[model samples]
Target: MGMIVPSLAHWLEASELLNGKGMFMTGTDTNVGKTWVGKQLIHTLRVLGREVIPRKPVESGWNADIQQTDAWQLANAAGLELDNSICPYRFSAAISPPRAAHLVGKHLTLQTLAATCPTRWDKRQFLYVEGAGGFYSPIADDGLNADLAQILGLPVVLVAENKLGCINHVLLAAEAIQQRRVPFAGVILNNRQSLPESMDNLNDLRAYLTVPVVTFPAT
Candidate 1:
């Protein structure tokens, strides 16, 4: 299916991008559980009576056992079909998005990605966008996650794995997001693994950053 039409009002309200209950999920690093936390977020929102459409604009690491890509997992989480509307681009190589796209002789651009977004937002209550790699990881040849996030102009929800050295990564990512003047929507600390430094790292992040920090227990 092609891009769904997004709400014009949402596109115009640049200042209040996240103000309308939509969010863009980014991460401190790859394998940081961005999708793990995002999946739970979708479930929680659904229980709260909000119709959420999750978007993982670009993803790598194909899991053929389940189907093809991470989009399949996310689609299942959202209870939607594995359609291009949800993930505009999907690559098979377990590498950075730009390199993955290069292998297939196709180039990913911010314009093409931004254009893939739902053209008209009608009944959908929320648009939850997920980014590939880390905040500064190269998503396209010319753009990074920061660039895409800016183009989409949604409140940033930073997902970080609760582990040793996460404090530094999370803080650095937060700094980068703020530097770009993106709307900050707080952080989610995902306990994808049990580590002794988890609580200390979590506490440090909460103390260091002013944005709200929520925890996701290991599951």
Candidate 2:
């Protein structure tokens, strides 16, 4: 589908709904620029004059500061001063949330994560919930990101970063979303796959996924 505006700019416009609603940003897989996309969403909202707080329900592994995860990126991009508890669960291991949390001797619950989010229309400028890993990524022993989104009752914006395997991953994620009865806003394709073989499959993906594919090519 054709884009209405740059992804970030479009998210800036979507921030208007956050006064009474929230937005869930999930991805097709890990390392798919999910952090980048979530940050842009918050940054756009802040630029649009909204006080937006970005969050990652569950994070795993840290390069240096354990607290400086995806949530930090969003806060930095949005220029918002958010306390560490704004993103409650910080797990180490750099793996899927549940596994990473287990490795770090921390167990996270979706209900707690959902409940801990900064709620209330007046309390927060806007809430941007970024999922750990992908829609089907495990947040708890059995809970997935879709479960988190369902509890939040927010429209999902899926981020697909792979070029070749994206269509399959996207369709799988859509199925998960449907199973959880969550509303999907659309899918954004992080256009970083440039291998000739991978590039050859881009058009194929554009034709297959049942949702709009918003591509963010490498600059």
lDDT of 1 by residue, 1-219 (tens): 222223212222332433366777889988888787777666655554557777888777766675536677677777788888888787889999889999999899987777766545655477888888889988888899999889988888888887777888888999999999988878777776777642567667778887767666623
Flag regions of model 2 displaced more than 4 Å. 1-7, 10-20, 65-68, 195-211
Quote model 1's TM-score. 0.85
Task: Give the best candidate by lDDT.
Answer: 1
Can you give the TM-score per candidate against the true fold?
Answer: 0.85, 0.80
* Residues 1-219, model 2: lDDT tens digits: 122336556533443343436678888878899887676556556655667767766677755763366767776766756566666677657787778877857777778888767667654477778888878878877688878888889878888875666778888887788778877666767766466642544456557655455556433
Clash counts per candidate, in order, are 7, 1
Stretches of candidate 1 off by over 4 Å are 1-19, 119-124, 197-199
Best by TM-score: 1
